[model samples]
Target: MTQDLYRLIYLSRNTIPGSNENIHQEIEQILAVSRQRNAASQITGALMFNRECFAQVLEGAHDDIQATFERIQCDPRHADVVVLDFKPVEARRFSHWSMGYIGYDTLASKEFTQIQQATGFDAKQFSGERIYDLLHAHLYAAEKAGSGLGKIA
Candidate 1:
């Protein structure tokens, strides 16, 4: 039987109540763990941290994605977790990545400028589909260059 695939996208505010350094360190740790866990579970997606908030897309088997999101919801590092979209998908959008990532440094780039215009520069203003589009752009770019995520310029 073909494995069923699902996609879930969410937005959450960075509520790591502490110093900026602590928050950065925590995010790094989360990325490291997510990469390992996602790869092992055959999940793929992208995470975008725009200094103040996070937008993440997860694609995998239904149970895997659901369990992953549940774990994310329980994390105290972020709050107000909002599920933007969750539905069955025909294919994985970020197949080459376990958990690709992008951060604030790409904010000034022209390619990102276009994405911002399309998805709204402010995370709060983005729709679920718009966020997915932005993440897909970074994912495809990373794959084409044979590089990992977080390298988008």
Candidate 2:
């Protein structure tokens, strides 16, 4: 990957239970700062929050992305962050947004219940787009997550 092309991949798990809505407020603040800085200059990526975990891909200046993620980690709203991957990208997979994503609380309802009912699977082991799928089913797009990438990306 070119030096100019770097991506920060990480995860965001919520720390506060029953704290879905508050995460949205935090994200709005983040977006405001990012936009004020110029969306095209410092770009973050996408996020997928399983009811239990979060995953993300961030793209832009290496230091900026990492520092931003650290801020998110310290945010009382989330925790248990595992940075599964980080490095240069041959190309951008989720390159379209300034910061695009959803929070884990997106699954705090019907679909999570159904998954629990159907698979008897404890969410801790779930992965991939599966969590996002559940969130999509239960929440409105607005409630799902707009721009903050929910710290996952």
lDDT of each: 0.78, 0.54
Candidate 1 lDDT over 45-140, as tens digits, reads 888876677888999999999999999999988888888899998888788778888776664234444554676645556577877887787667
Candidate 2 off by > 4 Å: 17-41, 103-153
Clash-forming residue pairs, model 1 = none
Clashes of each: 0, 3
- Per residue, candidate 2 scores C-alpha lDDT tens digits across 37-125 of 43545665655555555555567777777667777678775676666456766665444455555554454444544554575544444
Model 1: how far residue 100 lies from native, Å: 0.4
Q: Cα deviation in Å at residue 93, candidate 1? A: 0.9
Which candidate gets the maximum TM-score versus the true structure? 1
